[model samples]
Target chain A: MPVSNSLRSLLPVLILLVLFALVPLLSPSNRFLSLAISAGINVIALYGLSVLFGQTGILSMGHAALVGIGAYTAAIVARDFNVGFWLSIPLAGIMAAIVAALIGVPSLRVSGHHFVIMTFAFGQLLSIILTNGGDYTGAASGLDVQQPVALFGLSMDVLTHYYLMVVSFVALSAIASWAIINSRYGRTLRAIRENEKLAASLGINVGRHKIGAFVVSGIFAGVSGVLLAYFLRHISPSQFASFPSIYLALMVMIGGARLLLGPLAGGILVAFLPELLNLDPVQSRILYGVCLIAVILLLPNGLIAGIVAGWYRFFDRRPVQPNEPAVEREGK
Target chain B: MDVLLQQILNGLSIASVITLIAVGVTLIFGLTGIINFAHGEFLMVGSIVTWLAVSNGVSFWLAIILAMIVVAVMGFALERGLFRFTLERPTNGFIVSLGLIIVLQHIVILFWNANQKSIPRPLNTVWEIGGVRIASVRVMVIFITAAVVAMTFVAITRSRYGRALRASVEDRDTAALMGIPVRRYITGVFVLGSALAGLGGGLLIALFPITPFTGGTMVMKGFAVALIGGLGNLTGAVVAGLILGIVEGLSAGYGFSGWTDAYSFGLMILVLLFRPNGLFGGTSGPKMA
Candidate 1:
């Protein structure tokens, strides 16, 4: 890469990395660390979702199931078989990815409301299975997990785990998002989203692309789930319910799904919005519902897209070429 | 055999309540091309209103009718105020309806204090035939629900209003070109659907307690049944409703009592996987159009 191109490419991520490294050192409080950890987890999960939602244009209402799969897989493996945390975490993501692929075969056939309902039921079924599997799965109370594995000779502690989570959070989101958005696969997925029939006519395998998106989404959700389980030390069916999935989708929408900064903004908002408002549990939900409405009405293309469009119009100092009228350019 | 009969009766009672909700959902989808996520909230409003009215010295029958009328008015107001402007954007209407669900839910909580309220059943009569005992309230619900279903079926199929509704569903622009009052028909359908939902809610009050959050599960069931029997197919919705009711009843009966609640949702997922168009959903081509 050219020197200027490399610097331009690395600048934003370097800034983000510096910010992540400084967060814990500046705050150092347990509560802040906890909140930061939770937000990190959400960012990771939302990363996978942005790929499927922003790239493939598939709206899944049951993504928490994939997260649950990751959490439970990690929990069960680490607890029952006493596997290392590193080994168990990846296993959780793989398990979720496999299940997502299986479901995607049929789900990719349906679109719009049909796909939404399909994913919704899939999430419900995952919860039911966890709740019904009495002794082995611990039924409704959810299973518990063991502590983190030491990295070689180094002992793992909570603060260390928190930083590790932050690193993974930044790395997974930035790398995965950059890779997908720039790849040929991502282009094909975008084509499918724009117009599936047209994409098929152009020799794109729409179904395979959709399944790949679902699997990739599930993989991210799973890894996030494992991190969540490790951070909390417990996993419950309630944690993976439909409400969280809806909240995740809303977060992506509010932050701007197609933008890298969108999930980060959303994760922060979803985490702190309730606390900032000091809302009671039920009232918090009402506020969330209202927020969803406000976002949809005001930000049709999402907050990031809105801001970008506004920024480009204001600061970009290109002369108004009469032949290249703004309206005609925008029409494309 | 008696246990089976009792279970069947129980299933029928459940189906009676679900049929009302499902049919309303189907009607709204058919006529307006809008999915009212808040349809369950209307049921919630119906039940809460009936409970409040009856507790405040109104006759049960009067309270039930009053609830239906009130919900119908709310439906009309909704169409006139919000839905009419959103006809060009169905997706906007859907998301807005979800917002309405939260707003309505909070309003209920604010008024009713989040407590579960039970309506008193006036009927103490019971029938024991061939060693099977049937609660009079269940029998009453079944008869009333059956009558409503029959009347609704006839009204939609034979009446001039029904023909207009059918015309609107077939092609909204063509119906307008044919000089049919499309807006009036849409509003009427919304009102009628809400009335049925309210009526169902009132009847359901005899069997179960009502809470502010009760409509969420019921709405999921309505969606499931509507999908299974096929959207825009009234007869299919009715059959699907009964099938769902029976599935839940059997799940509750066969020692997996808690699993009963998950049965419909599970069935919905399974059906979507195998038959995305639903069991009787005809013509996959026009699903979106």
Candidate 2:
């Protein structure tokens, strides 16, 4: 407990400083830069889902809808109005957050399997609307986003996008992970996850907390989507299909849903595994299924959780000192 | 009047297929609380197997029987290899099933290609009555579905195996305490459920082209039907399937063919919002146990 307390006390500041120093140097090559960029986007998106799933215990099969909303918002603003990238990015994220809140209103009424169905339906409906929205959404052909413009005299390029994504992903994941574990709000959310009625009896407004988490999750997903749109310079309904939501869920599970960096670890593993294998789309999906099953069966606590716990045990081998009450309390 | 009769007949044929699929899904979910998304892939496999068997000169009925047996084996293997491992963690079980769906669909694509494949029509007659036109094949489908449903009803309500399965559904631990072999019953349900799915696939081949991607639509519709009737409710699945078939038929007839897919999902969302327990399925309340 004392060892863990000391590590926890220093982790945040260490992580932030390390990330800030390492991000700019991450562009080893164009391919590496792109993978890093995409991984960052995935981390941002899964951050939202993790809060809902890990914290609030609501499984949303439609988190991609928020991503799609953000992507489309950026696409529409950039392509249609020829707006600046800086202006459109925030606008898109804002629009996605708002849409997520609206859908969350109805979704907050249900939880567990019922919530899963609602989110799945919402995602499907969004896809249908986007596909059939005709001229506005470019119909089934999808929308084409222009390359982002120069900001602060720095040209928009692969390296720039990669660094930007890394900054956003690390910044958001850190805040969200810290906020959930350290804040009273996080305590209430976790309590609701453990037992809704019990949490309610403890004077927590379960419904409001659920909606709040949903909204916050949506904001993270929106930011991810906006970055993704810029990275690809094109957005399509097909890219944000139901399957992506499933993949996100798989990533969360594989990374160990209970941990903050779980999504990042899971996302990178899943995303890179397929590319590394040079698998076709169908084969990739099949591998994902197989991988998911293996992970669930062998490592239910997820890859990161198992590793982190193992690392903690291996390093902190010393027995507790009797005079370490303050350290013990912090650890607990 | 003629159009109405034809539409009604069409509705019945579709409803029968849905009943086969939904009841299978409902039975498994009812007994085990495992939402097997891969259930539709069983149907897909069965159809392709029957197609292969029939093309090789096997009799239609014989091909169907063999396909059902094969799917039953696959179901058993899946249960032992995957589902059994995740019984204590149902959410993980769901993800596992979903993964299976992807794997199975890809396997289909590998063998059958992505193009649509059609089974040779074994029955080519059209039967007309009361100004209604029904394909002889479709009538056969309706008859087969009715017979299966009737047989299942008797088995569930009257047979010893049915009693044990029901007891297991009510309470697995208590059923075990009461001398029921819960594992055996679950294995039996998985086999039976897979067979029902195989039968549905065989029947569906007569009405629609089989494509590698066909399982997703069927799975979604089946889930919607199960949700509509309430989770694990057999009779609820029947009524709900029929209602869904009719709604789909009418939607397609009224020139909203594109929205036909949306209709079931829309209905499911409404149900989740208004009656999470389902219409006749009776209290699908989350099992905290």
Candidate 3:
């Protein structure tokens, strides 16, 4: 008999774990290690976006604001209340989740277009408030974050912080995303995405489910924000504008919205490419725009989904017969 | 009293510009069923081209017309090349427009060098009435907008092409079956919308300076107008634009100036809350998500 199906499916997870374990063993230079760490941070947020767009089909373009909220929360809490990273971390996620639910409640109740506009407004409103928030938010100049979050009474360096983030939050976030996508709630969400009316007819509260997805996505973004804040050591309103939201949306699309590993690939592409290629900011942005158009027109399901589907189509075709039974013909 | 009157005038002038831009968006949405984010860039194109023409010594009237023609042609080419492919899919159209936003802005910046450009106003004389001062340029803007709105009203109500556009917007397949060239009319709407946006941009030169990056803010305002008036509802768009202007004016005038953008956004949120179909109820339009 074949091995257990659960174990078989976990093979991919095992492989990824092994790869991550081997990451540090490669003895990468100071720079490569730093790049890898930032890529990891981006991946967490990318996965959050995947939950919203990929699983829920919400197409929100404001995850960046949630990320910013998370970052700001962490920075402010640390600066004012003298909280450690550990406490600030959970607080950030909670704060972002509340804001997401607040905005998502009414907007998500409306039609999809309104939802898009509302999410955009959420980002814009956040930036505006931050700008006028005066000394508390440091206004337009933004607040510089000090005090590295210490663990076990010891302050960590950049290199050690990278490992801790990767080994702890990054791994946990991935596992949590995997669990959410495979759970009963996840099944209902997927159903709603496929056909909202049908799902509602079947007794699924579509609105509630959509809100749940938004909150979960917001939590992911918040955690990612915390990571981003730690990485940058600063927090500001300009950092959270709709452009970053669009960038997150772009990253999700580039990776293929529906694939588990898609955002992982996408985050890496977005984070590392500009730095490695030394591309002009304007040129890189133009490249993103062109790629988005090309991807939608030529590969609407995203790059990975397109490739996998194409591969399956190539080798899985069945010959048609004029005399085939109706059932068989239908399957063909 | 003078301040209040002047603010009201400012609000009306702004409302007219917003209505001009919002109309273009609503027209495209009505016919093509896509929210064209690049509509603002059309305004940008119009302004820049007009500025270039004027600075190079072209007559102001000739420059504005040339600006309209160039932007309209660019709109037609974009529709045929890029937008036409995404017509049946609103979601794709949305994403494609975002892409076009990036591409168009950069292309403008690359050629124009990302500098703010302003034209010397030919009509700078200020008119005073009851302690309120109104720039002659403001008067010109209001007059031109009135004439254009009237012309547009006539075109949509009386002309054959306008009838075809309205018919297709009401029901596409039926219009096609009824011998209307639905495809051509859709493209025509795209061109017309672009031309209107271009002309609005040219008109804005008398009021304010512009840069290649200004399109982002304009598009946001256009979206606010479109949402407030119901998406795809032209009449609603016009009313919403004026309402936005008045709200912004009152808020900015009354010392809530720092929160001007906030007030506009808050109004949009309120509209989305109370009149999800827009202030003047219209079709919900297609939901993409």
Going through the candidates in order, what is the number of backbone clashes in each?
0, 0, 0
All candidates: DockQ:
0.41, 0.47, 0.44
Worst 10 residues of 3 chain A by lDDT: A323-332
Off by over 4 Å in 3: A1-35, A314-332, B286-289
Task: Sort by TM-score, best first.
Answer: 3, 1, 2
Report the poorest 10 consecutive residues by lDDT, candidate 2 chain A: A323-332
Worst 10 residues of 1 chain A by lDDT: A323-332
**RMSD score of candidate 3 (Å):** 4.7
**Candidate 1: which stretches are off by over 4 Å?**
A1-14, A149-164, A312-332, B77-103, B110-115, B273-277, B281-289
TM-score of each: 0.90, 0.89, 0.91
Per-residue CA lDDT of model 2 for A207-318, tens digit only, reads 7888888888888888788778877888888777677877887888788666666776787888788788999887888898888777777776678776766676699854
TM-score for candidate 2: 0.89
Residues B44-106 of candidate 1 have per-residue lDDT tens digits of 999998998999999889988999999999999987876765555455556557667777888
CA displacement after TM-score superposition, residue B167 of candidate 2 (Å): 2.2
